[model samples]
Target: MSERVLMKGNEALAEAAISAGCKCFFGYPITPQTEISAYLSKRLPKVGGVFLQAESEIAAINMVYGCAGTGTRCMTSSSSPGISLKSEGLSYIAGADLPCVVINVQRGGPGLGGIQPSQADYWQATRALGHGDFHVIVLAPSTVQEMADLVTRAFDLADEYRMPVMLLADGLLGQMMEPVVFKKREENGKSFDKSWAANGHGGKRKHNIINSLYLEATELEEKIHERFKRYDEIKAKHTMAESYMTDDADVIIAAYGSTARLARTAAEKARSLGIKAGVFRPITLYPFPVNELREATKTAKRVLVCEMSMGQMVDDVRLALECKIPVDFFGRTGGIIPKPEEILEKLKGV
Candidate 1:
């Protein structure tokens, strides 16, 4: 077992990515997540990896696109607005089926809202991360330990499915400190096949093309259909959630990332007050863990969703439960973090 080390969340995440065998990082400086780049800037070189701070988020994501086409394990990090700037490149990478990780250490935003934690990007990350008929796998980490742990998972998922994967965190997790135990990079001799990569073939095989553009409408549609099949497979196999004390509860609280931690605390408080409140946390945002959520909340009379945004994930919760049970929402937006007492109050009403 590795010794536990106290580290900031963003730095821990960066180091974990290195331990996951990420060979290159291309990113721009953005608050909350800048430490990821800063940490890697120094550490990646020490590990014989490459790190480059691009001129802009757009350039950074494109650089990721270029590197990923060569079948390298690579990633980028940015805050909300910076992620928006990289959206176009994100679409391009998805269309080409390049595997890479993108980390969003979120902050409040429509545009430069503030430098505090926010879950306002739920829609952007899962539904419309970029303009496309595509989806990236999104993982939400609720703890500093998860912030470190999810990096390797993100990279593995990216490689497994041949698509972009996102580690969706926020300022709270990014800036917080916690003790974490990082596993050594697994050195299994086996590697993912990269026969389709655009890396030089040493004149031994035909050139591999990595382009998203399909001039023919039918061809594009065919590619999209194929991709959707992969999405369906991922959804069926990879959806994940944590159901806490939900076996017998009248009220179920739905939350994710940093907000889920608070919800769990509130659930405990509710239990102390003779109220059966369970917390259901979705770990995979894109797959959304709908079936697991339905099972978790099956005994509930009502459901409450708490978030740092104005009811983005609540809609999903409502849909997941199919609206047979009443779903309520409580939120604090514009970079405000809600207290467990607030969630407890909401639970009391439920």
Candidate 2:
């Protein structure tokens, strides 16, 4: 067993990537997440890894594209605005079907809104990461331990499916400190067969082409259909969420990432006051665990979707439940995180 270590969320995330065998990291610094690049600057070289502070987010993501094209494990990190700049590269990566990791230590944003913790990127991360008919496996980690464990999982899933995987974390999860233990590389290693890696096959095998361009309309349409089929498989196999005390819950709080932590405590408070409260934490935001939530809330009279944004994920939750039960929302935006008491009050009333 690895010894426990006390660390901040951002630093832990970087170390986890190192453990996951990420040999190259290209990113520009952004608020609440600067520590990630700072930590890696000193750490990557010690492990023979490459860490390049790219000139801009655009440059960084393109660097990721280059590294991933060579079949090397690589990653990039940024906040909302930076992510926007990287979208072109992200779209290209998805279009080309390359495997890589992306981390979003999100801050309040419409356009450089604030430097504090916020979940405003929920829509941007899960809905419109880049322009195209594509999906990136999105995982929200609420704990520092999860910040570590899920990096390996992200890498595995990315390679397994030949796509990008995103760790969508908030600034709170990025800057806070926690005690965490990491799994050995042997325990959390890749399952993807690297036979598809772009490492030179010498003169033995046919050349492997990684591309997304299709000049013919029919060919492009066919490729799009093929990608959709794969997306459906992922949706079927990878939808994951955590249900707490929902068996007989009257009010179910639907939350994810950092906000879910608060919802859990509020649920306990609600329980003390004789309200049958529970929490549903969505771990995978893109391939949302829609069926699990609908089943869990079968007995629920109300489902409160709490977020740090202005009710972005609420739409998804409402859509999943199909308005069978009353779906409500409460949010504290521009980097404000709702307190447990405020959430408890809302839970009680709803």
Among the numbered candidates, top lDDT falls to: 1
Deviation in Å, model 1, residue 115 alpha carbon = 0.3
| Per-residue lDDT of candidate 2, residues 34-128 (tens digit) | 99999999999999999999999999999999889888899999998899999999999999888999999989888988999998888888889
lDDT of 1 by residue, 215-316 (tens): 999999999999999999999999989999999999999999999999999999999999999999999999899999999988999999999999898888
| Model 2 misplaced stretches (Cα beyond 4 Å) | none
lDDT of each: 0.93, 0.91
Score every model by TM-score: 0.98, 0.97
Q: Which stretches of candidate 1 lie over 4 Å from their true place?
A: 188-190
